[model samples]
Target chain A: MALTASDVTIHFGGVVAVNGMALDVMPGEIVGLIGPNGAGKTTFINCLSGTYRPNTGTALWQGDELIGLSPSALLRKGVARTFQNVASLHDLTVLDIAKLGAGVRRDRRTGGHLLDFFRSDRALEELLMESILAPLELNDVAHKPIQTLSYGRRKAVDLARALAGDPQLLLLDEPVAGLTSHEGMAMAAAVRDVRDRHGCAVIMVEHKMDVVMSTCDRVAVMAAGSKIFEGRPAEVQADPEVRRVYLGEP
Target chain B: MSTRHIAIAIGVAVVMAVLAVVLGRYGAYLVNAVAIAAIGALSLNLLIGYCGQISFAQGALLGVGAYTAGNLGNAGLDGAVAILGAGVLGALVSALIGLPAMRLRGLYFAIATLAAQAILEYLFKILDPLTNGVSGLVIKPPSIFGIPMTSDESLVLPSLVLLVIAWLVVSRLLRTDLGRAFLVVRESEIVAKGMGIDVGHTKLWAFLIGGFIAGMAGALIGFANRLASPEAFTLDLSADYIAMIIIGGLGTWPGPIIGAAFVVLLPEVIQRVGEAAGISDILSALRELAFGLLIILFLIFEPRGLTALLSRIKLRRIGVVPPAGLRATGEGSQSPEGRSR
Candidate 1:
């Protein structure tokens, strides 16, 4: 098993964002986290990814507790995540973002690794270009800044960045939320490719039902910050609770 | 940076050195002032421009360097060793200032650094043995490689070489992973954390490295002036360095040098123009007034700095539409590699 999160809960003043969230994923598994808008899908990912510490949780990843660890520490443990909306950074190119991903993968030793200073980026640039960017079809605009790219392409670059980290456990938060349908399908396909290539466990929070069905091996449904249902994608589609809460079925 | 950027740095250094030597004492003094300002400007750019740490403590940081180098030089150390000692001390002090930055950010952090500047300035005035209080520390000329640099002409080459080293270090640093982390941190700390960057550590490194460079520039100033005084490193000096980088195009390459030259020579050019026009009586008043007005104009009309302005002119002269990214960013002529310089 790669990640096993249980009883994860967090609150903001009077509101409980993620309450008693439980999840598990084995190596090479793709788990889809689906629900209505306020289901705390992203908040749960935040708990695992170290953006927020849960008030209650025991998230064990590869036998180590991950709840209190920082995002940088979790990354060294091979856990990486993408954003819901890609932030436009000034002057950084597609290759630059991918390079940043690959950079975090190096050394993985405890403490700040000063060795990165001695290492030349050119050596890894070729490898990143071949493996991450080329596969994402970002080779053409590898030098262009992310801000100048279309909304769809920027999202693709964000995925390329996450994948370059060579993660053992990847958390993608709405990877295709803002993309066109055609772009969305390409992103979904890319997600599957990453799973096949790296054999890493993935927890993807997405709103696109088609993407969730086609790309996910298993689906987990949430309602009001609790897991309402969990099963294979077909079973999830057939479940009445998931339909009423997520698919707007009366 | 790649080997090509390193080559460009060396070439620019050589050109600067030649210009320093050929320009007589007055011109070399101007060159020396510009070069030193460029070094200070680059350090501030790395902190404020690249790392997005708005510091009003640069003048104090430079003062730290000047005092350290002065004391070391007076104690019979070689000029090289004194400068190095200054840099190391600057890094340590800079890290100390950066501690609050770990907890505070933006306007709050800027205020904290301002407080640091005030505290350091107070220390400079009260620390009699080292700083010699308000009178300043007067020292014998420091020697590099056993040769005393007694004149501004003698200091020109060393200043240019130091500027070159500082430039190369900053450029090479930007290409490194830590340097890229600074950019991400600049954009958004939350995004930086999500990307797995230790934001606090990265900011500290920026302060340390920037302090080191600022210290080196301070060392050069101490050598040139042969005095280290509290008055020399006031908040006004800090604001001046800030203005240099802002007028130079915050994070652009060569922006510091252009901004530094403009800042250091504006008064001189204004004075010369007034004298030539038989207005010598009002030269000083006009110089100060014109200098203030021009910087204001640059800030309003060319906020991206003269580099972006030159780039726009070059683009127009060539009559070719720039790429979307270049157009959007408003940066100057990019290196062929299309990466950060």
Candidate 2:
């Protein structure tokens, strides 16, 4: 397993946010976490991303303990996440944010210089623009500041920032939320391409059923802070329990 | 980058030099004060404008540098050495202060910096022998490259040169990747951290750079006055520094210069108005009161400072109507195209 979570539990005061959640992500596969509102889907991603510390159990990346690490530390461990509410970076261009992601993977000594002297080593930035951003058809607005982009484009930039880290495992929170239908499919295609090109594990928390069905290799269903089922995307669709919990089927 | 900018800069420099020469001793004194204050104001602008950190301790850092220079000068050190020592000492102390406190945010950090200013001022007062207590220390005129600058006209040339150097350094630094990192930290720590930026370290660096500028300014002021007194580095001085940055435009290079000129000239204008009204003292008091009120007003309405306001006006004149897209959020947003559009 490239990433694994065993009996992870987190509580806010007396209320349980994530309870005894266990998940395993194999290398080079995209896993989907699907749930209703307040189902603790984002909460699980938060624990994995080190935004929230789990009260019990372990989160491991390649058998190294991943719980309680800072976001930057986790980034060093080759894990990265995108935010649902995107950050506002007013002074930088699109390339700047991309460079920031690349900067995370870079050693402090090499990248700390006032200028990017080793720009050749940072081919990932160019690759990201062409492969991920361009295929998402964000080329026309690639030079714009993130704030000037539409909500759909901003979310794409967020994904691009995550990709810049060259992460071994990527955690995405609502990657297609707020996007137009055309943009949503384009983003979904980009996610697939990122996995195809990078061979990285992906754990996505998404509300878009069409995206999950089409993009994810395996689907994990959650309801009220606990995973009810885990199987292939087709099996997940066939499972009556998942259908009842998430789709309101009998 | 533009011919107009170059022309304006050159014109201003010539006018300032001529003013120093043509205007008598009193005018030279005011010009010197403005030049020194502009250096300090620019330093604060780095923190206040670019880094989005408000500091009230710039004047205190300036005081520290001035005292260091004065003491070193009294010990029979050469002018250049004394001035250099003052700046180095001030930067060291400010960097030390930043190391622990840069982790904080908002009003909490501001309060910590203010407290630092208060404590430093007290230290200056308590160290009577070194700082000469509240009595202050008298310094001799500084000599640069065998040229004696004892008189106001002689001092003006050096002051203007230092001001230009300060402006150039600040301008150049803001265009680099390090400058972009400072802005990244200022915008959101979470985003910065996510991008693998050492947010704490970046904040500390900003504080250090700002302090270095303030320290250099302090050295210049000390040389101009040939004295170091506790009264020279008071809370009032700190407030004046804050006022200069706020009025000028905060983050832009020209903001501090304009702010320094306004604050320095406003008092003279008020004195004249006060003389005409036969309430000179009250008029001066009102100016001080107005200075404080202006800070509050800027915070409420135009926190981006005069530069942003002017840019908007210019845009309007060019027949460009800005969309009401992101202005509702107050803070400026960068477009995906990378401009601050």
lDDT at B72 for candidate 2?
Answer: 76
| Residue range A1-250, candidate 1, lDDT tens digits | 7788999999999999888999999999999999998999999999999999899989999899999999888877899999998988876788889988877766434434456666766768889899889888999989887776888899889888888888999999998997889999999999999899989999999999999999999999999999999999999988887788778664
Which stretches in model 1 have alpha-carbon errors above 4 Å?
A: A107-115, B2-4, B277-283, B286-295, B321-341
The prediction achieving the highest lDDT against the true structure is 1
Tell me the spans in candidate 2 whose CA falls farther than 4 Å from its real position. Answer: A109-136, B1-15, B22-27, B99-103, B145-147, B175-177, B276-279, B316-341
- Per-candidate RMSD, Å: 3.0, 3.9
Candidate 2 chain B, which ten residues in sequence have the lowest lDDT sum? B328-337
DockQ for every prediction shown: 0.53, 0.40
lDDT of 1 at A48: 92
